[model samples]
Target: MILLCPPGVYKAQSDTHLLAGRVAQLAHGRHVLDLGTGTGALALTGARAGAQSVTAVDLSRRCVATTRLNFLLHRRPVRVHRGDLYEPVRGRRFGLIVANPPYVPSETSVLPRHTRGRSWDAGPTGRAILDRICDGAPEHLEDDGTLLLVHSAVCGPERTLERLAAAGLSAEVVDRARIPFGPVMRSRAQLLERSGLIEPGEHLEELVVVEARRG
Candidate 1:
């Protein structure tokens, strides 16, 4: 599908494709939600996979515009909203929710306010947005619904599993891939090593897809 990613909008990358592949497997005829839907990559993937309906949420206006443009260009109908995480979809639920959130560990405790960094920096420990997604997803999911999330192992996949389980969902690491560190991770490799989040001289991080189901 044709997508126009203007300045400040995140371009689809490996993590996006990883989540898109999983979404394609399960989105057929299901109501699918795409959180942090940058470039509308995963949302378009779901629509192409025969999802009955697709709704996408993003905090960036540029991203929202870019996704809407992609949906129109591809002749795929997707409800696009601009808001933080689930804010735009309050009181709604879906059969499938997919996310490829910002997971690159950052030095600051507070997430970036306004910069390209917002696309990848997730504050110290890299759980700023991931934690929110895990905590709130159960409430937004229909019974027997599934949540598919992709992130770097540097953010602690085990913690995500525990949080999802604690939220009353059965969660597991469904997929994993080792990829070389991108610009963001490479820039902070030293800090990550000092924090013991990664081994010294490590140039790669494991990307994991955590699948959580609400029974």
Candidate 2:
């Protein structure tokens, strides 16, 4: 089974990705949940950081298999589930919910060149997944639990903060970085045009890490 499994079926070792190594440092010693846990990057990092338990979920079966393999490889106690955001984790709450969902503004193509799945697409406005995650997060987090997300600056941290407020969460900035533009930006622009999210010709110049906590 191991030999026949596709490359996508096993979690990969990536060093330069945004969330891989940074998660442990940020999520230290928390009861964490990793939404969209592709390749188990954040999940593994949480385990390494001394989380009580790491519950990671992904919509892709392949991603679930890969995450399972990664957990075993590290001998960490992680629960890998296959389902969309919050579905697999219904009735459960965490002290820290971390997600690196596809944040490319809608109309742009996700990276990796070959990905053509929900894991890579963020809908027409690129806020589809992020919106849903934020809307549902309050119910899945403890009063002091935090929701950590990495997304594009194009998506407008201001808008994200509004969404969090609508859901009764207080939003804050934890980190920021500038990534070179990609096809995702084109998609984001197109989505903004169609959805009236922004005037035509506006540009997004950076990415941001947003942290929100339930009241």
Candidate 3:
């Protein structure tokens, strides 16, 4: 199987861990979109999994260029575009849209540093990005298409499901795993107080995969 390690020149965290293979499992002969496609890991993985077409979007020009390089290096046919969220592909629908958006509560928090405003920060409660994604995802997804997202389980999967429900979508936790806490863990802990993120004395968590679909 072809693999993409990581890209150089961006301290931006990956959209998803083990993203390359993770996406391949869900993508098959479908048009796929990888939001915040750093290093094109997920996008390339989807392509190798036989996606009909794969498009990667990032706000960073460097990420866009890096994704193109990685795509060419892997001989994967993926279109890399520099844009925020769904701007580049506005009005276009996909069978699958995958994102590992910045779920950390604060952009200024010490974790992995990338160019400013890269969509990694999730605001004070870390739900900022999640909110937008939940609200806007339905518009971009086909009736039966799926939106796959990775975030901290600490972000309250129940809250996320509620937000999606409010947006006229149905969401469920498809996969979840634990990883080490980076510097941002501190702030998330504090914000949890306000958002009821998780409970105290609960084990700290790293990532969660939420797969939702529009009705």
For residues 1-215, could you state the per-residue lDDT of candidate 2 as single tens digits? 01223555323322115554456665776779999887787788788888887999987787888788778877788988988889998999998898888765544444332354455466555787888998999999987888888877656788889999999999987777765445545555666667776567766446677888876
Distance (Å) between predicted and true CA of 51, model 1? Answer: 0.6
Please list all clashing residue pairs in model 2, or write none if there are none.
105-188, 106-126, 106-187, 107-187, 108-187
Candidate 1 global TM-score: 0.98
In model 1, where do residues sit more than 4 Å from their true spots? none
Alpha-carbon deviation at 4 in model 2, angstroms:
14
Measured with C-alpha atoms, the lDDT of residue 136 in candidate 1 is: 97
Which pairs clash (backbone N, Cα, C closer than 3 Å) in model 3?
102-120
TM-scores of the models, in the order given: 0.98, 0.79, 0.82
Q: Give the TM-score of candidate 3.
A: 0.82
* Candidate 1 lDDT, 76-166, residue by residue in tens: 8999999999999999999999999999888897887578989999988999999999999988999979999999999999999999999
Task: For residues 107-204, write the lDDT of model 3, one tens digit per residue.
Answer: 34443436544445666667766777788788888778888888887667889889988988888877776765665566456656555666764545
Q: What is the lDDT of residue 208 in candidate 1?
A: 97
Q: Is candidate 1 or candidate 3 better by lDDT?
A: 1
